[model samples]
Target: MTRVAVVQSCTGIDPAANADALTAALGRAADGGAAIAFTPEMTGLLDRDRARAAACIVGEDEDRVLATAREVAARHGLWVQIGSLALRAEDGARSVNRGFLIDGAGAIRARYDKLHLFDVDLPGGESWRESSSYLAGERAVVAETPAGRLGMTICYDLRFPDLYRALSDAGATILAVPAAFTVPTGEAHWHVLLRARAIEAGAWVIAAAQSGRHADGRTTYGRSLVVDPWGEVVLDMGEGEGVGFAEIDAARIDEVRARVPALRHRRPIPRVEIAA
Candidate 1:
């Protein structure tokens, strides 16, 4: 069994402050004997203002949050997953929501950019046009890690099951879905969706999330979860910010799949024509 830590924290407009919070959280997770630590989305900055966020965004090499995380990971001898960092885009007009998997030696093992942007107009005047200021990623990422074959995804990608299926097909045993979800949607669909993903893929799902109101008045639903292969929620950090840990047993995947065999039972969809 691999002990993994999920960090639920409130991020604000300041990158330095966010980095500090994450560093402390990493230390706590290490103290708890966790081998891998996962942080929430937008771990660097959470400002809504496009200009201010853009100004605060820096290249991955120059990002204070990433640098701090690397240092902390090295110090603790821990594998750190920075859920998603807002980095300055090469085009200079937008930013990239990027997730990094750092090894115990503080070297980046893999990176995944968020593919599906959260572009929606919600009720109560809540609107987000993420595509306007964030470029969508074109590829999915699955990395080999000490815990298991890890599939990396971010906030909005949870809505897409095909991505998870693709990752599962690529030999992923653990799926990391670090998010900054809105309260309404999170309240209604978060647990259900995460559990469904775990059952369908027959893989462990680790979701570290952002919670509470941010500096820009936007609130996030906190309930970072670790779902087992049988769709059981092993851990849930309810409605607050902190670290949650769970043990992931690789044998659970084999046990669940041996019973259900759903993945092997999958067949290609057949085309049907409509007759008028």
Candidate 2:
């Protein structure tokens, strides 16, 4: 069994503070014998203003958060998945939600960008149009790890089952859905949607999430979890910032697949009528 640690955190405007919290959490995970550690989306910083976020973008080579995360992974001899960091885009006005997977030796193994943009209207006048400030990623990524083949994804991507399905088809035994989900949506759809993805894909799901209020006044859901292939909640931290750990036995994938054979049973979709 390979053990993975998920870090639940509240991000503010300070980059140093965020990294400090992450480093301390990493130490705790190391002490717990975790082979891999995952952090929430926007692990480095979280801001609400589009113009301010755009102005703070750092180049990939110069990103402090990624560099520090790589060093941490190397020092602990564990794989580290740093959730989406705001990256400088070509337009010089927008950022990308980028996920990185670093090896035990501090080398980058794979990276995935968040493809979906959270542009919606919620109850109580809550509205988020992520596309206004961010550009969506077009590719899917999966990396080989000691635990198994691990898939990568960021916040808002969790709502799209097709992405998870594609990741599973690409040999992802463990799906990482790191998110900074809002409280309203999270309370209603978080657990059920996460469990559904695990069950449908027959893969272990590790979701490290943002929690509490941010410096920008946005609130996150913060129930970081590790679910088994059987859709069992192995580790759950409810509504707070901390670290959660779970042992993932890769054999469970085969066991679940053999029992249901859902992947093999999939059929082509038939044409349906649509209103024009």
Candidate 3:
């Protein structure tokens, strides 16, 4: 069983303060015998005020939060999966939700930009226009990690199963979904969607999420989870802010897939024709 840790945190507006919290979490994860640690979305900075967020949101090369994470990962000899960071886009006007997988030695193994943008007006008068401030990513990403071949996706991407299918078909053994989800939606679909994805892909699913209320006055549904290939909840850190650990049994993937063989059975669907 490969040990992994999930860091559930309530990020604030200050990037410096957020970095301090993350570093401390990494220390605890390492000390707890976790080989790799995963953190939620907006690990760097979570500010609804884009005007205020602009100052801290810089290019990936100059992102202080990413820099801090890399240094800490290397020092602790632990692999770290940053759920996603808000970074200034190439055009310099918009931003991108990007996640990174850092090796134990501090080398970046892969980067997955969030593909799905949340643009909706909910029933409770809650509204978000992510596409207005962020550009959508076009491609999917899968990379190597100490735990296994990791498939990467951000929060909203969890709602889209095609991305997960592509990742699993590409030989991903473990799926990483790092999210900062809203309270309402998280409560309604968090557990079910995660379990379904694990069952469909027949791969272990690990979601490290942001929990509690943030400095930006937004509350996230915090229930970081780990589901085995058989759709069993191995670990669920409910409504708290801290690091939780779980064991990913590599053999479980083989056992589940061998029985289901869903991936092998997948066939291309043809276009529909209408008869008048």
RMSD of each: 1.0, 1.7, 1.0
User: On residues 1-276, what C-alpha lDDT tens digit does candidate 1 reach at each position?
Assistant: 999999999999998898889889999999999999999999989989987787889898899999999999999999999999999877776789999999999999999999999999988789999998889998999998878999999988999999999999999999999999999899899999999999999999999999998898899999999999999999999988899899999999999999999999988768988989
- TM-score of each prediction: 0.98, 0.95, 0.98
Q: Which stretches of candidate 1 lie over 4 Å from their true place?
A: none
Give the per-residue lDDT digits (tens) of candidate 2, residues 143-216: 99888899898878888999998899898999999999999999999999999999999999999999998998
lDDT of 3 by residue, 14-60 (tens): 98999999899999999999999999989999998878988899998
lDDT for 169 (candidate 2): 88
Q: What overall lDDT, based on C-alpha atoms, would model 2 receive against the true structure?
A: 0.88
Q: Ten-residue segment with the worst summed lDDT in candidate 1? A: 86-95
Greater-lDDT candidate between 1 and 2 = 1
Q: For model 3, how many clashes?
A: 0
